[model samples]
Target: YNKYFSLGISVADEMFGLLFFVLMAHTAYGDVSYSFLEEMKRGSVIGNIAKDLVLDVNRLSSRKARIDTEGNRKRYCDINLNTGELTVAERIDREEICEKKSSCVINQELVLENPLGLHRVIFNIEDINDNSPQFKQSVIKFEIRESALKGSRYLLDEAHDADISMNAVQSYMLQENEHFLLRVLTRTNGRTYGELVLNKELDREQQKEVTLILTAVDGGTPPRSGTVAIHVTVLDANDNAPLILPSCLIPGCVHIGYNITITATDEGSPPLSSTKNIHLTVADVNDNPPVFQEQSYRAHVQENNKPGSSICSVSATDPDWRQNGTVV
Candidate 1:
């Protein structure tokens, strides 16, 4: 009787062990999405890092789990095996990789053990306006002719921004100036360039040099900007004629011992003024009246002197030329 009872107990224990094995729970693989800033430091925790992978490790003591990137392309991130924590392995720069594209996606896979599973992670690297607009040169220089017509256009070297999307360079601004305007152009590579267009004419005589400031701005929340100083020099042109200045002396009339001076001014590159000195040599026209040496001439005459005899000689002179001064 004792042998038969022990056999029945062993059979019951075996049957129950088989039933528990048939009812064992099976774990399923998990999938999830996560977001992180572009430049997260290494060793930082990324919570909810596929927490469903192992479910409850405390309750499922038999479950073992781990996460790793696909192959050797773990350029941006690393994952914790025991804690299911994700961390940055290397700094990620969206602009450097995206190149102004609309989206940046980093495709990776994390593997889990115990209840074997495979999971895919899609990391969307977002952009931030961390870069300021930059110019190739700090100072721009140009030499233009003063007579250049209005509506002339001058192409300039383009500016660059290290960020993409709205953080990239959008437009340009020129300082308030009466002589020029600003224009923007886009290239096939999505690079925006700038130009200086002449709206008003220039005059070298009036203004020799012009200093302007060009600013490039981006379309960020707090827009970033950069500036370049533009220096333009206007060249001289011979557009004016010389001018004669009136002298104090009158023309076409002269007298002895008189002087005359002539002057002229030029509007050349280096303006100049010239003067000429002249001495007048008078020519007589018999305009002077004859006069005696004394204010009143006293002629001594003997009473009843001979009628044909000249009592005293009277003298007179004329200022006309030899032929015209002949007196009768």
Candidate 2:
């Protein structure tokens, strides 16, 4: 029986095009594991295997099964010359290599010269508790309305860890706050996030501001953790009724001259309402009366003056303006 695995790569470029394919497989097992995060030297033994039924361990076939890394990834391991055991070729940083991926494997091609056969081996890099969780920012700020009801959930930024599996971020903890609690939401992709839930109503006049501490811990011996500072500000709510300003000042009587604009304001978050246009009307008060410029007027005209002859005109002034200032 023959067992075979194939890898196909298609590349397209404006000036060039290339298609690549390679095949690799193990004689018995398909995958293997190695402890990562440790300082691996250039020739540290990782595993042992036989080549062409030569398991004597004296005359090994390491040269026949030379190690070859794929693409641009630096070679991390190679087989020993006399022992025929896989050895570390270069230092491997699991965090930098895998990042957010769950399945982290190293691909290598082992080519034998005598029979001219190529075999691929997948080395699964097992994670260790080497990295701590980290948040994108040092401080997070949340602005909420004072009228927000209880049981409201606010989404929060998630913490990230370079490690994977049990070594990755496991849980989140929020510092005890009287009006707020913390919740962790797990997604379909096995990702977790932090959420701040309101336990009671917020009052801007009573407590305008609050601070919380969020911590993320990983599942490891002597677990490592990270923290983020959370600051929440309660916004004002519309609670006061509209207030009309005390009347406008008048010099003489501006009612007939110009229109007065009175303002109505409130003590809410938006202090002013849309109804800022006020129609100020001057009420009619029967008080001051218009008086003529002179108490008496004497007009001297020639005898037998023309029917439509000109005569002296009288003018009057009133202290009150607008409707009260009207004089005939």
Candidate 3:
């Protein structure tokens, strides 16, 4: 028995052009599925099988049935006189996807049957980025330690001004470090830094200091420049000791506890002159024999029967400077 279903229609340029009729059924056991009896085929006609039935002329049958002939075995559906239902011979939606103009289907309108159902199908498309990275500010500056080695990583004060996707921001470039020895360290948020690490350590005696410049770039379709200047100041290490100058300028004139002025200076940056203004204290040494104030003194100790008893103590003082003045 044929069952009635819904219809779908679409129009273009203010005229109805596309129409689809879908048919679904409840079998004898009450299970809902589509029927495959009648479909769109050539020469198949959708007319009332029972002519004397009391149904409306145009409402009796939907022309969605199968054409049933040997050479013209196209599918078409006939109008149900009792139920006003359409019967399809093949799958409804797959048969009616025509891209041409003025194309029509006889019984293939079942494609739009479940257009609003949750089981409807759809397609999605995606887009990509193609723009290169640039710098927000033309120039940026940061400090670098002169002691930093070539190829050592120095963080940038500015970051790239583009979205961080492979198509948008491809890779990074450096204007300097041409030896291909420089390396880059990137942060999680796309910030980048370069290293000028040392191929060999520097000697303070040969070259006291130096300076360097740095720049950054990104890899895109058309690359962008993000250049920055790095100012590095190499400081001197205290490798040289203080040297005493004009050793013989004073001759045996120092007295006990008298502070003498001896000059000592280091041959380094700033103030290469001798450290003459600095005073050096001189203490009297044991050059002369120790003279007793009272010639000699006598001490008496009583004999003790018990052990661990103190007998007598004496002390002396020397008027010298540094470690020499104190005795252990």
Q: Residues 1-328, candidate 1: write the lDDT tens digits.
A: 1222355457796665453432232212445556666766777665546464545534232444444454555556666555556777778887776776777877665544465445666678888888999998998999988878899999987778888878889999999998999988888977789889999988998999999999999999899999999999998776655555444443333556856777777767667666766776644566666666667667877788877997667677766666657665
lDDT of 2 by residue, 1-328 (tens): 1222221112233212111122232233233344454456667777774543344455347336676667756777777767778777777777678766776777766555443445556677767788899999999899999889999999989999888777788899999988899999889888789899999899888999999999999988889999999999999888555655556643443355344465566666567553344555555554788899899999998898889988889999877657777887
Badly placed stretches (over 4 Å) of model 2 are 1-43, 51-65, 112-118, 238-328
- RMSD from true fold, candidate 3: 21.3
For residue 322, give model 2's deviation from the true position in Å.
52
Report lDDT (CA) for all predictions.
0.71, 0.72, 0.38
Per-residue alpha-carbon lDDT of candidate 3 for residues 263-322, written as tens digits (9 for 90 to 100): 566656543434444344443444443334555667676776468666555555554444
The local lDDT score (0 to 100) that residue 287 gets in candidate 3 is 49
On TM-score, the stronger of 1 and 2 is 1
Model 1: lowest-lDDT 10 consecutive positions = 19-28
Best by TM-score: 1
Tell me the spans in candidate 1 whose CA falls farther than 4 Å from its real position: 1-32, 43-47, 52-67, 80-83, 185-191, 245-328
Q: Could you tell me the TM-score of candidate 1?
A: 0.62
TM-score of every model? 0.62, 0.58, 0.29
